[model samples]
Target: MDERDGKHQDAAQPEFRPYHHPAAGWGAAKSVTEFLVRERELVNGPRAIMKMNHENGGFDCPGCAWPDDTKGLHLDICENGIKHVTWEMTRKRVDREFFAAHPVAELAEWSDFDLEDQGRLTEPMRYDPASDHYVPISWAEAFALVGRTLQELDSPDQAAFYTSGRLGNEATFLYQLMAREFGTNNLPDCSNMCHEASGRALQASLGTGKGTVDLKDWEMTDALFILGVNAASNAPRMLTALAEAYRRGAQIVHINPLVEAASTRTIIPHEFARMATFRPTRTGTLNLQPRIGGDMALVRGMAKAVLEEQKSDPKALDVEFIERHTAGFAEYRALCEATSWDEIERQSGVGRAEILTAARVYCEADRSIVSWCLGVTQHEHGVDTVREIVNLLLMRGNLGREGAGPSPVRGHSNVQGNRTCGIDHRPDEAFLQRLAGVCDIDPPRAHGLDTVGTVEAMHRGDVKVFVGMGGNFALAAPDTPYTSAALRKCLLTVHVSTKLNRSHLVHGRQALILPCLGRTEKDHQRGSLQATSVEDSMSMVHLSVGMKRPASPHLLSEPAIIAGMARAALPGSNTPWEKYVEDYDRIRDTMAQVLDGFEDFNRRVRLPLGFRLRQPARELVFRTPSGRAEFSTAALPDVVPVAGTLALGTMRSHDQWNTTIYSDNDRYRGIKNLRTLVFMNADDMRDRGIRRFDDVDITSTARDGSTRTLRRYKAIPYDIPRGCAAGYMPEMNVLCAIGDYSTQSDQPLMKHLKVTVEASQPAG
Candidate 1:
């Protein structure tokens, strides 16, 4: 690698073609083979890791939140899970010599893949502005520097603490405990960017903020509505569930602007014959392609159809359930009656025929479920759209019953678990009182900043220190340049991480990278190998015990690191930080005290396959303000873009998970060896006088007359909506301003943007 003028050596020209195969069969096999070949030096390690991954007594796959069966079945992991595992357990290492040879300035310009590809961090390191490189530092000095910086701050509010989804419940509890004890509520996390909309919307309508359905619900559902969830890429394990539902003769409907490969076909990983024949089973019996930001209108149309059907048979409308279990139904029904089909089609970009087809499927099923992902959450009307979905479910009384409810397919492994474990900026009074009673520390009451709030606060010169427990905050947050500038302006930035990322390069005046044990590595503290717990997508809390040895002797567990920092920062605190680290069960004991649903935490988590947490919404107990389920209504997103602009959708390639790029190829989308390519409709390209593979510049036109532009993106004509274009995230994240988020949830509209595309070079 060159020391100056940074550029990736592995960056390829990229070959693009139409992918015609099913989602998960031979193609998935090839991807796993490639991962194995790349990590050949890590010999027998691969076989052993695969045998234990996602099992009852094994470590959890730190990728997506899709639940595991814990059977230790044959090759129990998917292609995406294997990529995350090998990437984490790779033989490559980043030691003192590696940093000495490369400067931070040069590394900052490296590709995201290259930055992480350098390998696992081995020890604590500090940034030296004079030399433009990082140097080794003692753990004590690192902690002392951070504590002194906190002491020197005017108030704890100036310091922001961020967490990621990979952390266990115990570690997250301690991390949040430290943040609250230090008198700041700035506990921003990945959930703020991805599923905050789901939580906020559901909590307002139902009592709980979690999904009400579990894996067993798939077997009972007669029909499923999958909105904006890409099963092939984001959560491949769900495809198995979909296939099982199909075998049981369940109808599935898919709605999205971009027609994903998995939406049409799938292969169950455990079904040996299906994997061998490559004869994929159909997933979506009916697919609806709504316009960008049109999910609310589509669901509204579905509700309209449901009401119209009730005119023929009043029983079609669950009158008894609505009267006994819900509120605001009369107002919601009146609004639907007043809504026009023409208006619905105009806003949703779907004709009456397709809308009626989906409604028919919904009306015919005795038991139904609606599942969605980021595509439904990362929009201006994200929360409204989710509530509309709930409105549809209420029409049929599809909630509080077997195989019926709403499920938001979360992205990270334990994102929902993190929130349940108290990683919130706004803590409830009851939770705070319980925490204070046990920890003997006066926790902060003021609501802290979310992800966007932190970036804006830093930009306005309000924040001085940023301590990231995990995750690449710089690249993950919206408005990349602005967030990076905010990080650079900080007094100090500290990252407790297992590997290097873009967040480390966008440093403050003084920065530190504190190496920590990865999920795949054994976290042996106080002479005993410890196990952590991760709550899955279905609200199942299970034990995760690492099998592989620690990658580095110097690395510490995340809990140990957090406890050490807490001791240094709160010198006079009475909390037994070290005692909890000695045995994680003590931490669990403490959790059982402050948190609900964890009564007998140690005893329950130790059981085979662990246990499922309580979800009050599933028990016909709507804990809303009115003590009943509520229905919500909102104006349709009538966002008519300018004449020259096309609605843009930012997506993740199949090869990546979150901000980490596992490879340069995405065979699922048929783009090989490149991340700079953009997917557009062929007709849209023709209308814009652009050809396939033509290098273009995307200019994002914000409402404030301010704009952000990305250069050198090769436009590839593919299958998408006529007026919509799609590109990978972080590359397109620059175009979205941090302030341009949903009005209620404040989730960055990464999936919806107003943009105009043109040739890279002027009219030659």
Candidate 2:
């Protein structure tokens, strides 16, 4: 009866509709191809659409990192990349006799969608601890026990590695060429845990860590904004570029804390000639919401109400592009005219005429953009809330031009091409002198470890080998019982996945798992069959290849298990990891001789659908270090010592994606069945004495007083926003605290999280 089940919601709410979706966009690509043929058993439907656009193509859809719109081939997929290509072309597998019949504590109590639908794992395992399970080994004893623990580590900065932009671009350029030829730059990734505070506040305001618009910069924007992102379920084709900037007459606005229905409209249904000719599109013209960690006090009170409406209107300020291209305008206009309006309307719940009507739509936009995601880099002053949206787009003269700047929106599918093919945990000396002139050694320049300094250096034993190369890092890490006890005090962990998670049964004292190949299969190398390269979320860079074939037959190809563990750990390096896997254009000509808009990397990633990179905000160029644009110094407070508690936020569940949960449905907030639950604001859950389906326990504390909790859950009050609250994500990732992050890019502030609730168990 999934006739769009809870179709277009709002029946006094509580209506449900995800997992097997429908309300529109062509019944969401035919309810995700009928949940990929009746609940993900994907039997070759039209040979999976003729190998999803061939040319060696392996359906490049691991959800949202969106690019491919060379203004065509537009099925650029997203409802979590159609649940990551129907959960990787699922037809289920798990093999090796499903680990000789369960065990590993009964597959660590299932669910994470029944251990990823007990599928596609196939072989090469390890963790046996006397058959507690995970047997089959041999990939030459898993690269000779990972090259005898990187030649007994001692100090390659105690080995970390991490990376997980679903490793491609030739297994993250051969897993950062086996950690810079095993010398160190320890290499942490998952883009330093989600947009390293929008890449250190847009590479310190705008030299670029990437993102200065270009999805045709939302068609020459005249006003867009949209903060702390939810772009209709995390990048749903950026709701057709915010319905083409609300159909030409731009001005969209949005900001967030929850109000996402792709900001409001979107019914594409393959535009059935404008939905059987009814005509829809143009959504949000305002929206707002704010409050939970109030986006850096609501974008510095909309840049202090556009400098108090340009002090009695001096043409509402843009003073010749802030006096010829910006740089700290009079100490940020005297700290926004000595900040006050009752502390920016009680720390931004909005109203100083909605921050002076979003500062007169950014002073009547001449070209604007602003964008954001992971709700402004998951907070705690997320890089001063992304430099207060780059001080409200450099108080006019928005960095660069045509539709202005600051985009962000990245989340894998080459999470920004695994840090531009290096997998940096920090590394610059012109990318280690062009990787010491293409792998002739001498790489490490110190600085590494970032996913919270590699989980506080693996809980302080200074990490002894972990390696990931494909995430689910113990359920997208952050206090999942302290990241499964810092991955059971690692003494060698490894994963290189293709499915079967819960961090491969959270093992350690030596664990493995291998099982590679799955971008939708078929990779093959050495015998001529390669083609990788990723980079998206607008900086372009392309070429991918895999068109479904091997889900098994002993998988492989994460650049052939990182070049067979870098030819069994460096046995005298001189990298050519077998001539870049027999031609991935010699790893895109050695990642264009050590990366940076890859200097014509193999004829611009084979042109057709790749090549753009160079976005100094599309030419108006403001590479910061004083060649213009700067202005920050005015955001010195966003206080949050749980002042009368209740901030929360954490999200994900359009049948989930990150921390991959999938079905405990959240069909545009009319939840179904439930996945812990929480919501709030039904009169702030009746003035904090909460009720409707009670079962509390959310805790929080930290700043060293360590509190944390999470338990029972189930709150549900609804229409959030009064000092907000909301939940979901690796089961409320234990009410936040992987060192409650983001004091300039440590990034774990899982959408703010102040806490302080009571009743731990009531309406059972």
Candidate 3:
């Protein structure tokens, strides 16, 4: 092999090290300047960053809230986040000429990263079959067409409105309003794909859809159970809290199939080279690597261990809290006692000793917190897994404590906020009743379609029109081939976004692209500047103001886009849609009138750092139907390995944010330039007769006669558990079938799939 090929092959090898991963937000050198040049279109680079930070104050970096040294006003965005910011602020324009030069068919073959890197969509465009290109259309014409399509639908259910968590509260509220005003409550946000399982489990157990702990709660917690999450890369700001927890003698236990860097020591750049270069920041006290799709088993083992320990020493559990505040403990205890340790050990890949040790630590701690992200929620039995985790916490009376509760590490800045502000498929009766009062129109009481339901409807031709508020639907979904085919069945598709993405290429017959304002841009409505609110994972609501100017004068705010669409869809509807757009407070006032937590939305949201929503459970108040906390006992046995098969997980690259790709570089894995590859255990690779750098094919055994195969991927061996493998999603989505989704939450189980792999034919 040549030097370049040899270097690439060498870099592809997996090196299992024990150091903390690179800083995700603030540690990358030149991240700010690079962002200014690429995302902000500032010719003066660092000068632009300085000006924005001083006078306008650069908007919260449009990145993860991994804490920065705000005292020193240093920029704290990560490598990927910098790329995300720069990508959004990019001057690269995908105008009519760009479209005219490339047909939709040709663009479809381009990688997801390449398609988005071309830059922002500058004008409204509609797909034309004859020309095979998206031709620019007049705004008036586009809105009229959208109205006509929605109006022609046989029923409101025939069309669906989808929202992404990345959207601001103002935009999400307006988008939901448009759907409700159009006579359908079919509003499903991106949460339907990621954390719906967490919401379901938490709401059923505690009567709250969000986490019971706030950011301040960390200060009081004695121990933290970081389950199925990689906070180091996904949310680096969390490391600061964890580091503090370590310094305070709070034990942190990390559970995941991957031995991520965050579970080790990290260098804090903001702390200066004094500690950064010499000493690594301690992140976790214990690290456990369970098998893929084995979270349920691991959690069950933990609960079982807790129960067994409590039997020997009654003081091991919080008997007072359990007797006073919980129900169904007897049945749950019986189930745990009957569960076999051999089964748990086989599935979790962790011995009884390890589980008992973790359980003892949790029991001894006055306050213990459990936090998980997509890892625990993106499985066939994700809901049960979360329910079991709650069971473990409840056994020790951890619910509603200062540092003890379940925390779902949410994706996207405003995903949780989107759900908070009425972007739900199944709105509760109380929330719906309040919403009806706001608009003076009775909203739909029946449940609406979720992300999977919407896709299925489109596939069955039951849905004719699809409207996306912000996310790239085609790219975020599993089974890319099936999802693309489903999109083709829709008669009309509308995408309101800031940049050009792959979803735009997989279009309906009459697809309309609506360009909207980015979070980094100043939002001007009527005569005043507007600010939007985003709810973090801790239920802390904060106000975000844009510093950069609009990428284009023609660009409209998401709220305005929804209002314009509403005007067209319902001509002469007496609702003051235009008035609400002019003033967002009026919108917040209406929202507050309908939602219980925001009694003083306008005044409360104006605070320097927004107000926290009222959460009774944070103080240990149970609002369940029984007026007590509930415990569920369901033990997940190991997935019996077939004669020849493995559990594969679909993941995102470090250079990627959801479906948007910044580059092919995955710095943590030492991967750069290329992304089409899978990471597998070295033993598994050898046993399957697959060699390193060998082109391999992964085929999914669909229940139907059809088979989906992802071809020509290089296999890179790593230190993963046996029977566990991982490949990047959107590309390997083809392996996931249409019906292969979680039954309870309807979220796609993209993280867990059964597949067979073999060598692919060499390129002729």
Q: TM-score of the candidate numbered 2?
A: 0.35
lDDT of 1 by residue, 1-764 (tens): 00111122355677898788888888887777877888763474466556544555678888888887645465657888878888888788999999999999889767898889888999999999999999999999999999899989999999999999998899999999999999999999999999999999899999789889988887689999999888899998888788778877999999998778888787766678877777788877888988888788999999999999988978778888889999999899889888899999888889999999999999999999999999899988899999999989988999999999998999899999999999999889999999999889899899999999999988888999999988899989998888999999999999998889999999899999999998888888878989999899889988888877878899999999999888889999898999999999999999999998999999998887788999898998988999999999676778555677888988899989888988777788888877776788898889888898887888887766678888767889887877788888867788888778888898888988888888787534
Candidate 1 CA-lDDT value: 0.87
lDDT of 2 by residue, 1-764 (tens): 00000111122333333222223465456556766765545566435544442324435566678665555544545445665676777777897788988878987876777788777788888988887888898898899899889888788888788888777676787787788778888788777767887877777766677777877767778888888777656677777767767887898988886776777777665466776765667667887877776677777777778777777887667788888777788887788778877787777777777877887888888788888878778776778778878877878767676768778788666788888777887877988898787778887787877777777788777987888877788878776777778878989898988888899888678889898887766677756667676777877777777766787879888887888888887888777787777667877777777777688689876767667778664575766678766778846466443445788878786767787665666667667666766677778777778787676666777677778766666677766677678787777776667788876777787777777766575435
Candidate 1 stretches with Cα past 4 Å from truth are 1-11, 41-45, 52-55, 70-74, 762-764
* Clash count of each predicted structure: 0, 9, 10
- What is every candidate's alpha-carbon RMSD to the true fold? 2.4, 23.6, 3.9
Candidate 2 clashes between residue pairs 3 or more apart in a chain or in different chains: 25-269, 26-269, 56-546, 57-546, 57-547, 58-546, 58-547, 93-119, 103-106
Q: Give the TM-score of candidate 3.
A: 0.93
Candidate 1 local lDDT, residue 584: 95
Ranking by TM-score: 1, 3, 2
TM-score of each: 0.97, 0.35, 0.93
What lDDT would each prediction earn against the true structure? 0.87, 0.73, 0.76
Worst 10 residues of 3 by lDDT: 1-10
Local error of candidate 3 at 382, Å? 0.5
Clashing pairs in model 1, backbone N/Cα/C closer than 3 A: none
